[model samples]
Target: MMILVTGGARSGKSRHAEALIGDSSQVSVYRYLANP
Candidate 1:
């Protein structure tokens, strides 16, 4: 599963991603990248 969230800092990106994930056991690895 893959999700792409693009927004400014502290814009609920992580929160939304967590909600989308929602206790899913399949998603074993998680990664985050920041670009300026």
Candidate 2:
């Protein structure tokens, strides 16, 4: 399963995403992508 988090700046998307992943045991690996 995959979850995508998106929102305006400072919207806590990453924080919420981390919280979700932190509560899951099935997720063993994670990757972060960003544009430079």
Candidate 3:
């Protein structure tokens, strides 16, 4: 399974996502996207 978390810059989106997924024992893969 995959999850994509997004929000405006400096919106603490990543922190929110981490908290949501923090209790899982499964493997997680994170990918970061950059706009050019």
Candidate 4:
């Protein structure tokens, strides 16, 4: 499964994404992709 979170800067996108993943029961690994 894959999830993409996009929003304005400092809008808690990462935090929200992490929460979703943390609440999941089937997620085993996480890879962060950032481009600046």
Query: Best TM-score goes to which candidate?
Result: 2
Q: What does candidate 2's lDDT look like per residue over 1-36, in tens digits? A: 888888887888878888888999895455566778
Name every residue pair that clashes in candidate 4: none
TM-score of 3: 0.60
Q: What ranges in model 3 sit over 4 Å off?
A: none
- What does candidate 3's lDDT look like per residue over 1-36, in tens digits? 777899999888878778767866787766666679
Model 1 TM-score, 2 decimals? 0.59
Evaluated at residue 16, the lDDT of candidate 2 is 86
Clash number by candidate, in order: 0, 0, 0, 0
| Candidate 1 weakest ten by summed lDDT | 23-32
The stretch of ten residues in a row with the least summed lDDT in candidate 3 is: 23-32
User: All candidates' TM-scores?
Assistant: 0.59, 0.69, 0.60, 0.65
Report the C-alpha lDDT of model 4 over 1-36, residue by residue, as the tens digit: 788788887888878888888899994466566678
Clashing pairs in 1: none
Q: Could you give candidate 1's per-residue lDDT for residues 1-36 as a string of tens digits? A: 666877899898888777767777675455677776
Cα lDDT for residue 30, candidate 3: 60
Q: Kindly report which residue stretches of model 1 are placed more than 4 angstroms away from their true locations once superposed.
A: 23-28
